[model samples]
Target: MDVSQVLRMNGGDRDYSYSNNSFLQRKVISMTKPIIDDALANLYLDMNHPKNLIMADLGCSSGPNTLLVASELIKSIDKIRLKLGSDELPEIQFYLNDLPHNDFNTIFHYVSKFQKNLRNQMLSNSSPTCYVSGVPGSFYNRLFPRKSIHFVYSSYSLMWLSQVPEMVNTNKGNIYMSTTSPPSVIKAYHEQFQNDFFTFLKCRAEEVVSGGCMVLTILGRQSDDPCSKECCYVWDLLATSLNDMVSEGLIEEEKLDSFNIPQYTPSPKVSNEVEKEGSFVIDRLEVSEVNWDASTDHNLNLSGEHEQGYNMGKCMRAVAEPLVLSHFGESVIEEVFKRYTNNIKVSMSKEKTTLVNVTVSMTRKG
Candidate 1:
């Protein structure tokens, strides 16, 4: 599918833009903030007191969430400099990276505002010179110079494989790894994930300095089984939505059969295996559950389950619509998400649905 040319979050600041629908991502970033803070502190301890610090946020899609990790990083380092009684803060160079098709302009538009906000928060002398630039490319390949970055961070990314490995004709009416998928389909997905993840680590290893740190938060599976419900149910429901449309003659059945998402939720065991093969020391790897409706605020006393489902549907559409539109015709986008929203509401009414996210903290091997 030429994923790099086609894949991107829904752009601009509309209701369906990734910027508006990225509450779950924001929550994950917030949840991992303390861990990231500690990792940065340790990274500073390990760094040889450099005059400049380079940091990159890989898969940094546009929106308010794009600069979030970078902002927090600068704050963390600033705190460390203050504690050490340093007269000068290191020059901080922030690199935001994503696939070529990502909305870099949206991110660039906010850079000045981000810098101004930072200036307002810190003293003139204490404020480090922060240079922000966009690097548009895939992270699975080399994106930065060797030993150039001090800290690397990615959130709600890495689950997306470079592309869907081998078309699945055997698995009918399903779009992702499901229990109904054949053994070959499962094997293909696992192998693709291993290769992509290994390449990702290798590329970062070359870019990050010795003793530098990396923090990654990826959509993952709680169970070692590749077709675990925690990972596959969402796709299953999405497939169901497509099938419903097919039955209604809105979308062709053949179109549904040929489409599959280029995403894999690896188990922690898989992550450990890949880490061992890469040039990094795994400091911490943990899986946490994030509810589908985690982003919704119940305090507002909104229109109950349907509203929450609609919001969650928007979140999924923000991330998946572009891909779906590329495969299926654009005419079906609204109906697909409408059905998806109903499916989500129905599932939420029955029980809680959550996805497992894996957060890995690592240091470059010396």
Candidate 2:
């Protein structure tokens, strides 16, 4: 599949759009605040308090959280400057990047408002202005000039592969890795992730200035086992719904078997790839758990009388609809996710909680 052309969060400002339903993603960003802080502090120290900071947030899906990462990073650096008793904050050039199909227009519309909010948050009156722009391309390919970026940021994005594994055809009856999947299926996912992540590090190594840092948060697993509960269980639960639809003649069985998510849940030990790529060193690696249904509104983005399952269903729809729509077509999407919501409720009843995320802070080797 041409993932760059089709895979995207639900675009536009509908109730089911990623913009409205991405509270969980926002929460992950907030959850890693200290790591961002640490990265910024180290950046200043390692780079000798540089006067200009050039940064990019890869896979910056549109929504409130779109600019939230940029705003928070700017604020963090300002505090770092103040703590170091600097007279002025560094000038910032921030680029927001994602695939061609990402809702760049939505974020473009919000930039002016984001600028206003950012100015209000700064404590220092200095000429260090921040410029924001959108760069549309696959990060899997090179997206920036060599040694130009001072910091690279990504959250909940690296888990997605550049493309579905070519060999996944053998993993019939599952959308992703599962307990029922053969070892060949697991091997295929592992190889794809290794290639993709190594490519990611190699490209960033060329683009980031020596000593610059990347603070990345990706959905991951702690166990080496591919079928670890926290790994692709959420996706497995989603696939269960599609399978049910297939059983009921609502969807074709062959259609469900042919589909595979272009995603991989890597363990923190993927630093092996970083070392092999050999341009960056891991500074801080931490794994944390956030509930699958962590939002304050269990009703999700819906208005009246919704529950946890309904909300999760909406949230997953926001993130996964585009991919599923590209695969199964729009005809059965509603019924599939409706069934997905029920599956989520059942999983929750059995104490299926938490999404495992790995946060790794790394610096380009000088």
Candidate 3:
């Protein structure tokens, strides 16, 4: 399967759209704001005064978060400019990137409103001319000209491999690596991530200018064990849901065995790929756990887990609906997620599980 085509989140601003269900991503973006501010402050301090700045938000799937992030960068820079009292403002270029199947049209459609709000907010000062363009393609390949970008930020991406591993029957009855998966299956997943991340680093090394910074947030694991409950429980539960459907004859057993999610929850050691490729230096690697449901910030229903589990199901459906449709067809989605919700309730009741998030900050060598 072509991951670029099928790996997109559900688009548009509907109930199940990524736009609505992306509170977790929103929290990730907020958590990285200080890192971004530091990167921008350091960018200005490290280089001679420049008249233009180019930044790229990799895998910038369509949503309000897209503009929220852009605004955050602009606001951070505005603070710097105010502090420095600089009359000469640098022109800013924002390359909003994603795959061909992403909802670029919706993003573009909202740009007018976004621009107007930006202008209104910055009316008191000289704001940089912000140009937003959509670049459609995979970041695993080169997406920008040599030394073209100044700051690069990506979040909740980079876990997806370019393609699924080409092995057969290694992880039967499951869609992703679980505790029950064999060593061979785990080895294949790690090898694929090593290659993909190296390529991503090498490509960015060429595109990002000297002294530039890249602040990335990736989904990862807490334990060295690849199959630990912290790393694989969510997917394992999903696979269990699929298996239940197959037992009920709602889905094909053969299809369940063949499907594999082309994502890996990497350890911080995964950054060794950067040292291996030798283009950038890792500035900082930090790990934090986020609630599986962003709404848990308020209260978690550990007793029955109805609302929380239902929210988790909606979130998963927003991200996984397309992939399931591409491979398993549309017939089983409702039932699969129905069972997935119930399974999440039982599992959450048993254990209050959280997602492991890894944030990495890096800088390109001069």
Candidate 4:
């Protein structure tokens, strides 16, 4: 697979083959609200000088979802300031980062809208100045001023490596690796995922101020059994379905082997590696086994779900369209998506719909 063609959108999931945007937002808000609240309690941030804190939202996709999370964090900062009895709060430099292809115009517009609300609120003279900028490029590389950030947060982003792992290509069809899975492939990808992830931390360790905190919400599974695809079966299911299409001539075989999705999940090993790097210390590890109410009206779901649905489709096209067209001709993609959509609808027919789960880790590095 020519993985290079797959552009990483901000830092969100790369293999969302069955995504639905609205659904994803609701689910994410429900799941992360508490995590955000807890991070505030754990970090002891004060609003008296909220401006001194520089915070970032990595892989902040376009839409109300990113703003929703940002608003909660802003509120927490405000609450902390009110408690500190400060006449003037410090400015908060907000970095909204994502893949270069993300909807920055819309994000910029949203930030402007948020700013308007802040001004309209008649905030005290001490309210923090919010600085928003778009960091377009790979999170695998440095994304901001060194040692400038005070707190870093990423929701459902870190699980994806900069690109797909090399092992899947080398191992052919016999490999499945993620954060929590069989020890070997999990260990292999862990080694790789950690290497990339630790490099992220190490860079942040340099960029983050002393005593700074970082909170990340990532997808994960509970069992150690590597082959247990329960947590991250979406990709495997899509892959198998694609392979079947190839076998039956529903799609060309050449296109089948040439496509790879850039999505991944993290294991405890990711945290372990961060700690071993000697710059970051784990403060909390919380995993949520969230099950999608497949029965619920899909319209009520969250940004996470849309991402899942889209990657399962939107992103798949963005990444795989060229390969499919080049290998099987452009005329085949429409038919491909139609069948793909049908496959997803059919897969959701059970009484219960479940996903692997998400793991959130709160850490501090000095």
The prediction achieving the highest TM-score against the true structure is 2
Q: For model 1, how does the per-residue alpha-carbon lDDT over 17-125 read when each residue is reduced to its tens digit? A: 9988888888888888887988888887777456789899999999999987778889878887777766677899999999988999999998889988887776435
lDDT of 3 by residue, 1-366 (tens): 889879898999998898877877888788777877888888876766567889899999988889888888887877776677666667889999999999999899998888788877773466458999999999999999999999999998899899998774458887888877877888898889888998999899999999999999889987898888887888888899999888898888988888999998887877787789998888888888887767333444344544666677777888888988899888878888888878886776677878888888889998
lDDT of each: 0.86, 0.87, 0.84, 0.59
- What TM value does model 1 have? 0.95
Better of 1 and 3 by TM-score: 1
Model 4 misplacement above 4 A: 1-5, 9-22, 41-50, 118-128, 168-188, 293-330, 361-363
Q: lDDT: which candidate is best?
A: 2
Steric clash pairs (candidate 3): none
TM-score of 4: 0.78
Q: Report residue 196 deviation for candidate 3 (angstroms).
A: 0.4
Which of candidates 3 and 4 reaches a greater lDDT? 3
Which rank order by lDDT, best down to worst?
2, 1, 3, 4
Model 3 lDDT on a 0 to 1 scale = 0.84
| Position 234, candidate 2: lDDT | 86
- Model 3 segments more than 4 A misplaced: 295-306
Comparing 1 with 2 on TM-score, the higher-scoring candidate is 2
